[model samples]
Target: MAVLTYREALNDALREEMERDDSIFIIGEEVGEYDGAYKVTKGLLDQFGEWRVRDAPIAELGFAGLGVGAAMAGLRPIVEFMTWNFALLAIDEVVNAAAKMFQMSGGQYNVPIVFRGPGGAALQLAAQHSQSPEPWYSYVPGLKVIAPATAKDAKGLLKSAVRDNDPVVFIESEIMYNLVRDEVPEEEYLTPIGKAEVKREGSDVTVVCHSKMVHQALAAARVLEKEDIDVEVLDLRTVRPLDVGAIVASVKKTNRAVVAEEGWPMCNVGAQVVDDIQREAFDSLDAPVARVNGLDVPMPYAKNLEKLATPNADHVAAAVRHVCYAD
Candidate 1:
């Protein structure tokens, strides 16, 4: 095992996958010459040359469409959007073409491609740049969505996503890329998609979350521990093929739950989780399922406003307390 940053782990995953499969290639803006927007693709260009590590223009629509076509031709392509906000321009290709191609064509064409990039709010990316689109893609039928919260998950899940035989939306976060570091296994491994991981176990309450919110949930759990409240942190790594079984198991054990997410509350991932919990573990639940969601407003330009809009440890703690009836 080696302690690595989220960026380094992702770099390792891409490198290893490309090395293992000659057909796998990466394409996006500044991916080759500039080494990626967040330097996640650092040194990949020199190692694999410009052909494999390509840098496209500032055109998301054209490049994303091209990648969809390439995937149909039996090449595994990794398409990076500078940010998901930019990927919005290419949603036509992602949702209409890549996502529905296989099933729409009766399995004649499988778009084995991965669309990845930093998503959700950053330090002060402002309204246009700050947004979380996981629910938008996860709502589709043929697409798989994953958001890795740890370096180990960042590496393992990415490898699995790249190798999967379907379209996947691999969402990363600018807030977590370098801020969170952990020991990731050096051996070749794959974290199966559609599985949830219990990050920190407890008995009082279950905290459901993914992406950067997982860090906040962990921090909140630590604080709650001081007051004799045992909080379990459940990371929903894969959003689309959600590990509903894991969620049910956690809720059954804890009997109380709180969901944390960076997205707005309405029709968010948390709502889906809440529905699942109420249906499968309704009798197990001791209290109502509470959620710590992002402030239901467009992201503001001010730094403080941005902070308030994003979910933090304090927000998570309050939600957990509410579920536990300690608020």
Candidate 2:
């Protein structure tokens, strides 16, 4: 096992996948000659050449549509959007063609393609670029939505997404790419989609979250432990086909649940999880479930305002305690 940053793990996955499969190639803005906006694809162009590691024009819709077409024609194409905020330009291709192709074709065709790039809030990137669009993509059928919170999960899930038979949206956090470091096995591995990982175990309350919010939940759990309030933190790695069973079981033991997410509370993935828990484990819950989510407003450019919009460790801890001890 070697310690690697989230960015390095992603690079390793792409490098290995391209080497193992001839049909697999990367196409995106600044991916080839520029080595990626985050340098995750650095040195790939020099090794794989222009044909495999291509730098497409800044037309997200055009290249996304091209990637969908290529995947339909039996080529495995990975389309990077620079940032998922820009992916709005290619919504027609991603939501319509890529997501609906296999089902529309009556299963005769499987678009083995991966649409990836940095996603979520970073610094003071304001409203447009700071939006978390994973829920939007997860709403569509035929598209697999994945967001990895750890270096190991990032590497394993990317490989799994690339090799899958359907379209996959592999979202990475811009902030976490260089910040978090963890041990990643050198040998190839794949974390199956739709599985939930228990990052920490406790018997008081369950905190379910994804991506960077998972880290926030874990940190909150640590603080809660100091206050004698045990908390279980679950990382829902994949958004679609969410692992409801894992969440139910955790809530069953703890008798309390707090859903944490980076996005707004309304129509968010956290709401879905909380609904599922109530439906499945209503009797087991000792208190009403709580949702710790971003403020229901556009992210602001100011650092303090941005911090207030996003759920932090303290916010998660408070939510857990409120849910656990509420009368």
Candidate 3:
């Protein structure tokens, strides 16, 4: 096992995949000469050469469409947007062409590609650059969404996304690139595309979350541990094929749930989790499911307001306590 930073794990995944498949290439803004805005693509240009490791002009719509065309022609492309916020510029291609190609063509064309980048609020990037747009793609039927909270899943899931035949949206967190460290397997490994990993097992309450919110849920679990409140933390590794089974099992054991997310409360991924929990595990529930989400307003620029705008450990912990009636 190797203790690696989240960025290093992603780099290793791309490097390893390229070695195994000559058809795979990476293209995005500043990904080559500049080594990526977050340095996730550092050293790839020198190793893979200019053609495979490429840099694109600052046009998300154009390059994104180009990548979609490449996929239709049987070339595997990893298209990195600077952030999912910038991905809004290319939503048409993602939602229309890449997602609808196979069904639109009666299974003749499958756009097997990955659109990846850091997402959600990081420091104080403001409203334009800080929103979490995962629900937009998750709401679509043809796309698969994966958000890894640690280095291990970051490595394995990206490799799996590269190998899959469907279009995948891989969302990373800019603030977590260095903050999270995990001992990743030295050899090749691939996390399943539609699985939820139980990070911590408990019997009191279940906390469902994904991406950076996983960290918040884990932290809340540790705090509740001191108060004799056991919290089960589930890292929803993939968003599209929601792991309803894992969530239902956890809720059956705990009999209460709290969903924590960085996105706005309305129609977010958490809302879907709540729907499944109530539908499948309603009889086991001891209390109404609680939800902790980012403030509905646009992300603020001030550091203090930004902190308040996002969901944190305290908010998550309070929700867990409220559900368990331990507050």
Q: Better model by lDDT, 1 or 2?
A: 1
In candidate 3, what are the lDDT values of residues 1-327, reduced to their tens digit?
Answer: 889999999999999999999999999999999999999999999999988988999999999999999999999999999899999999999999999999999999999999999999988899999988888999998999999999999999999999999999999989999999999999888999999999999999999999998999989889999999999999999999999999999999999999988999899999999999999999999999999999999998999999998999999999998998988
Candidates in order have lDDT scores of 0.94, 0.92, 0.94
Of 2 and 3, which scores higher on TM-score? 3
Order candidates by TM-score, high to low: 3, 1, 2
Could you give candidate 1's per-residue lDDT for residues 159-186 as a string of tens digits? 9999998999999988788898999987
Compared with the true structure, the alpha-carbon lDDT of candidate 1 equals 0.94
Model 3 worst lDDT run, 10 consecutive residues: 128-137
- Off by more than 4 A, model 3: none
Off by over 4 Å in 1: none
After TM-score superposition, what is the CA distance of residue 65 in candidate 1 from its true location, in Å? 0.9
Q: After superposition, how far is residue 311 of candidate 1 from its true place, in Å?
A: 1.0
Clashing pairs in 1: none
